[model samples]
Target: MGLKIYNTLKREKEDFIPQNPPYVGMYVCGPTVYGNSHLGHARSYTSFDVIYRYLKYCGYKVRYVQNITDVGHLVGDADEGEDKISRQAALEKQEPVEIAYKYELSYFEDMRKLNILPPDISCRATGHIIEIISHVQALIEKGYAYVTDKGNVYFEVKKFASYGKLSGRNLDDTKSGERIDIATDKKAPEDFALWKSADGGHLMKWPSPWGDGYPGWHIECSVMSRKYIGDTLDIHGGGMDNIFPHHECEIAQSEALTEKPFVRYFIHNNMLTVNGSKMGKSLGNFIVLKDLFKKMNPMVLRFYILQSHYRSVLDFSDESMTAAGVGFERLRNSIFALKDVKIAENDDLTAYPELDALKKEFLDAMNDDFNTPIAISVLYEILKHSNNELNKADRDTAKLEAVKRMIFTFTEDILGFNWNMADNTDSGEENNREDKLIEFLIEIRKQYRTEKNFAMSDKIRDTLKDIGITLKDAPQGTTYTIS
Candidate 1:
């Protein structure tokens, strides 16, 4: 079966076919860049990173565009609140651009640590003001938007018959769901802003036909994605929270202007929760990525996320993270164990059905909606088989080589685990031998101490202490740690 993705637009799994064969254009909504990224941001970006990697693995030339929302993301919906960057700038007593730049750099740094590939084009919202204004002008000319007396341009949601198709919300229901005051400038309660006029000397405002104003939150994505990718995107993705107003409004404005489908497939990853509660800064329950990295390896965090299906809700807890670290170490250690195997000169015509089955299972799992959890299970199965083969008294050297290549292909090449332990030529093998020898001597020392041979134990401890390794004794037991 070909790749099957669960499209939020159809609310079902659909076969993925790019608009142009072998060339896929995917746009995922990126961070607003007003503050440090949180775990939720990690989940969304890492999920798409896998998608991007797998697409290339399947021989598709994919151009992934993730926008940086440096401006135009308001505090509240319907464009009646201050921009997020503006609020952060006010509190920090700096320009909004300064805040955006600071957090944008931090975001990429965190993503790089997590092994998330940078997008092909990261278009900033503020950098595309001219394109956004032109987009709004096209909407106005098509009779789908109106300019208010205050120089605010609002998209007439009622004018677009299919405004709620992507979100599956009708106009009446959307209007009734609004519990806050509606902007008087909007033509209707469901109408959203295409542009909002600056009340005073707004720091992020730009010159548009409507006056000194800025593009609306939803308009920013529509303009940037279309300009960077195309009028029609092969895939549009983000967290599920953007389903209703943010993505819905993007579809309405873009389709109304082009009279064509804006996105072929819409992918939304589920949110991350902490202790069964949704993670958000407003909730005071979010864990910043940088702070979390202090206590955890970034790859362990990525492994924890991929343990569950992308569409499934993942909960964060100390126990879960610890278990993930252990599991990730096991996975990595299994790969490292195979690095010492020497390839036999004779090619193995030996048909290993187990190896073939493992590869098939992995491909099947990934083909079914990029089910990474199942794919990881297959990795463990392959590792288990490799361990059993390695422990045999007489091993087939050629079979071992095949297993080694298979593990490398699945884990490092396909799954994005760098696992460069084999690449460190001088230290990698030497350290392995040293670690084993140290553990052996430590075990011998333990036996001596158990029999009350204090002199031998002390001699062993002092000899090791002369080197870099240090021995620590605790309530559990005596263990050796590298200094």
Candidate 2:
């Protein structure tokens, strides 16, 4: 079966077909670079990353574009309040540009840790002021937008009969659902800003048709997506929170200007919760990716996120993460063990129908709207069968090699797991030194146990455990697993 995508616009799974065959244009709403990346960022980006990888694996030339909101994203996420980056700048006593660049780097650093491939084009809002001004001008000329004497341009939501079509929120619904106070300059409460006049003290202002101002949060995506990837994108994705106001406004202004469909498929990933509560910095429950990486492998976090469907809410906690880590370790250990198995010079892969069936099931799950949870479950089934086959005395080396290739293809190539990092052996010389030190410590602990010094032996094991290493004592020797 061909790929099927759950289009949020249609509220159903539809066959995935790009506007142009063998070419796909995908745009995902990226983070506003005012703070460090968090669990929510990980879930959203990793979900898109898998989709990107699978598209390429299926022989599509995908041009992935992600935006960096360096300016004009208000604190209220609507037309009111200070820009998020500017607010952060004030609190930190830094320039707004400095704050945006700093956190933008931090965002990419965390993404790299998760093995998420970088987008083909990373556009910044501040860098595209020229195109934004042109877009706002077109909207005004088309009579869908109005400029205020206060130097603010707002989209006339009433002009677009299909203003809330993508979000399924009528103008009445929008007015009721709005959390932020509406700007007085807007003619209607449902109308959104296309461009905002920069205040006298605003640090990130640019010369626009109205005055010295910056583009609104919603307009940047519409302008950047159109500039980088035509007026109509094959796929547009983001977290579910963007359904209203942000994406709703984008649809209004974009279609009003282009007089054409904005996106073919609108895909949205569900939000992530922490300990059953909404994760927020204000709630004091926000989990940063860099902080979480210090506790466990980033790959483990990536693996944990993929255990749930993209359209499902992923409730995260220490317990759930620990369980995921154990499962990931099992799969990693089994796949890596095959490296030691010798491969037969000539072997037929079709000899094993069970392996072939498992592979097919894996593809089927992915084909059905990127169902990663089901796809990952199929990986476990493959692992179980491979273990059984490897246990037989007459196990076929060629079969073991096939298992290795299959696991690697799914886990690393498609799923985007970095095995070297997961195994805690990525750094060659440093890892070797660390391994030798761990062995030395294990040997010393063994001596302590041999002498019956229970206090020293237990202390050593507990110390290692505190540092995310668990010691397992087998009949032959002690082995450790790093979480």
Candidate 3:
């Protein structure tokens, strides 16, 4: 079967055929870079990373573009309030760009730890001010945008009849539910800003056509995506929280100017929740990626996310992470066992029908809108069968190797798991020796603990820590991880 994707634009799972064959252009909404990246950021990026990987695996030359909002993301999701970076800069007593660059680097570092591939183009809003100004000019010339006396420009949402099509709310209803703020001088309450007038106090103002101001939050993605990729995107992805107002305004302005579809496939990942509320900085319940990494393996967190469908809301808790860690260990152990099986010259033709069946099931699950949960189950099935075969009196070494290759293809290749990088890089014999020595030391430490020699056990841990090995004591037992 061909690939199918859940397009938020169409509101259904549709077959994914690229606008240009052998090439796909994807643009995902990136972070604001005003603060540290949290779990919500991880879910959105990881979800799109899988899509980018899968597209490339299917032979589409994918050019993925994710932008950084260094400026112009206002507070309260409105045309008012200080820019997020400006707000953070005032708190830190630093320049707005300084805060943006700091968090931007930190965000990339955390993403690298999670094994997410970098985008082909990491556009920044501030860097694209010229293009954004030109885009606003085109919108105004097309009569889709208008400027107020204060030099602030707003998109004419009434001029675009399909303003609320993406969010499924008509102008009448949107206006009825809209909360008018005294800060905006928009012609309509539902209309959004294209450009904002900045005062002397604003730290991040640029020379735009509308005076010293910055692009609006929604305009940056529309302008930057077109400048980097194209006017019509093959895939545009973000969290579901961005559907209304943000993406809604993007569609209004982009389509109003181009008179074409802004995005063909609109993919949205559901939010990650903690204690039944969204895990976000606004809620003060967010877990930063760097802090989470110090507690557990980053791949463990990735595996926990893969356990649920991207469209489904995932609840975060320590218990869920522990379960995911256990599952990840099981997967790694199975792959390790397969690789350990010795191979001799084999003339015997082993019929491993299970291997082919497992591949089919895995692909089928993935092709159905990237169903990673079901696909991961197929990995366990392959592992279970491989373990049973390896334990037999006459093991088919060729079959074992084939199973290992399949596991690598699914985990490392498609799922973006850096298994080999995370595992020992030494040769087989050297790794075996190191493993045995570590196990021996751990066993001796256990013996010391059993004898109530707390000082000796502590000494063992402290000595290992000094040598770049950190030991964590948990209910399961004490385990050492090499730093």
Instruction: For residues 297-351, write the lDDT of model 1, one tens digit per residue.
Output: 6777888999999999999998888888778888877778888999767668356
**Where does model 1 exceed 4 Å of error?**
421-483
Clashes of 1: 0
lDDT of 2 by residue, 1-483 (tens): 899999998999999999997999999999999999999999999999999999999999999999999999998787877899999999999999999999999999899989999999999999999999999999899899999999999989899999888888888888785756878878998888889998746779999879999888999999999999998999999999998878888888788888899999999999999999999999999999877776677888899999999999999998998899788888888887776877777787668888999999999999999999999999989888668877898988878878888988999999999888877723434545677888998999999999999899999999999998899999989999878
Candidate 2 Cα outliers beyond 4 Å, as residue runs = 177-179, 425-483
**Backbone clash count, each prediction separately:** 0, 0, 0
Reference-based lDDT, each prediction: 0.87, 0.90, 0.85
lDDT of 3 by residue, 380-440 (tens): 9989878988789987777887787788888987999887644632233454566678778
Whole-model lDDT, model 1: 0.87
lDDT of 2 at 269: 94
RMSD of 1: 10.9
User: Residue 33's C-alpha lDDT in candidate 1?
Assistant: 90
Q: Count clashing residue pairs in model 2.
A: 0
**442: Cα error in model 1, Å:** 39
